[model samples]
Target: MEKKELQYIHSFEEYVNEFINALIAYSPKLISAIFILIIGLYGIRLINRMVKKIMLKNEFDPTLSRFLASSLLWALRLLLFITVISRLGIESSSFVAILGAAGLAVGLSLQGSLSNFAGGVLIILFKPFRVGDSIEAQGVAGTVNEIQIFTTKLLTSNNQTIFIPNGILSNGIIINYSLQGVRRADLVFSLSYDTNIKTAKDIVMKVMTNHPKVLKNPLPAVSVKNLTDTSIVLAIQPWAKNADFSSMSSDILEQCKDAFDKAGVSIQPYTIEASK
Candidate 1:
């Protein structure tokens, strides 16, 4: 029994020596890996800051710049991790394969998200609309507040905030109202059938020309669009800056009404009847 106990003690001591030697042999590699990790993290931060500065200097869009910076940082950190693993005598090819498999699984599971990300990339590259541009698309109209990786934010004219998925927006037709800097205000009015078409047109043209916000170079147009049974449909088209479109149109409407009344032009009236 004593001999057996001594043999067991001897085996335990040998195991301990082996473990210690192995630890001693790998200690330098472990320390180097840790050092590389620390320095690599610091370097990533420095690179991120430098990239931000360069983007800002180049006048890159803020949303695109932020997205690019974060993506680059993560990619660099991933490369650093692979380097550290390789330095620790681990096969990096297997690690990369494992990462690729995981990425594929995640991508498959989040296909919609990936599509939105791709759509955002396309939008940033193509620039159909920019921040602050008034746009109508996807059955919604609003000013573009922000363009994000997966979604876009819009501030509606009625003071509502809307988040539209980038995938849908990119695929749809975008109507950028502010892109041309100027827009046409189309106004229609009904005059009594007895009213002289030429006189009514002259009144509308004068009002449009006298308006301070209306553009004269395009030459405001007033024409008889239709002859209804009870009235003559007159169409007034005026050009104005996009920013002043609403107010200019409203002013023209009010001014035309006042001028029509003063000029003795009869306006068509609407009457409703109750069913018997």
Candidate 2:
């Protein structure tokens, strides 16, 4: 019984010694890991602040600045996390391989969204259109309400909200109507064929020239554009400030009606087409 007890105590002592040896071996790795984590978190915070300052100094859009700053910070943090794991006596090669494979799969799945994100970034950086600007893009015409990372929101003339993907907007032609400082309002007036064309043109041109919003430098255009079965069509192009376009249009149409009546120019009747 004494021999058996001594043998059991010796085994326990050996087990304790082995455990201590293992712990001592891993202590340095644990310290290194803790050090990496602390330093990495500090570095991430510092980098985030620096990026924000740079973005602000460059006058980047608020949304864009926030997005870039957050993305960069998180990316740095992720790298630091991986490094910490490596310092903890972990074999990171397999983990890195797994992450690479997962990333490729995710990238493929999100290809379209990524494209839109990239396009949106380009739009924000280049500034093709600003909020409240009237623009035509992706076959939609409206006032830009907001520019997001993946999409653009527009308020239509008819008060409809439209959402267009940034990829389509960036790839296609963007017609910024507000950039010109002024836009031409195209007006077509149809008069009875029996009425004199020169008289009709003169009446329309006179009305356009008298409008307060009509620009005088570029000169208003009034000419016969088309001859239909029942009437002669007169085209009137008037340049007005962008903000005054709607007002000018309403005023011009009302003034033209009065002018036509005074000039004895008989307006033609309209016909509706049936769609098949």
lDDT of all the models against the reference? 0.89, 0.84
Q: What is candidate 2's TM-score against the reference?
A: 0.74
Off by over 4 Å in 1: 1-25, 269-276
What residue pairs are clashing in model 2? none
Q: Write the per-residue lDDT of candidate 2 for residues 1-276, one digit (tens) a residue.
A: 699999999999999999999999999999989988998898889889888998899998776687688779878988987899889867789889989999999999999998999888889888898888999987789999988888999999899999999998898999998987888888777888888877877887888888899999788898887888887877778888999888887788778879998888787757211110
Each prediction's TM-score against the native? 0.84, 0.74
- lDDT per residue for candidate 1 within 20-131, as digits (tens), equals 9999999999999999999999999999999999999999988779889988999999999999999899999999999999999999999999989999998888889889
Q: What is the lDDT of residue 55 in candidate 1?
A: 100
lDDT of 2: 0.84
Displacement of the residue 190 alpha carbon in candidate 1, Å: 2.3
How far does residue 194 in candidate 1 sit from its true spot (Å)?
2.4
Query: Ten-residue segment with the worst summed lDDT in candidate 2?
Result: 267-276
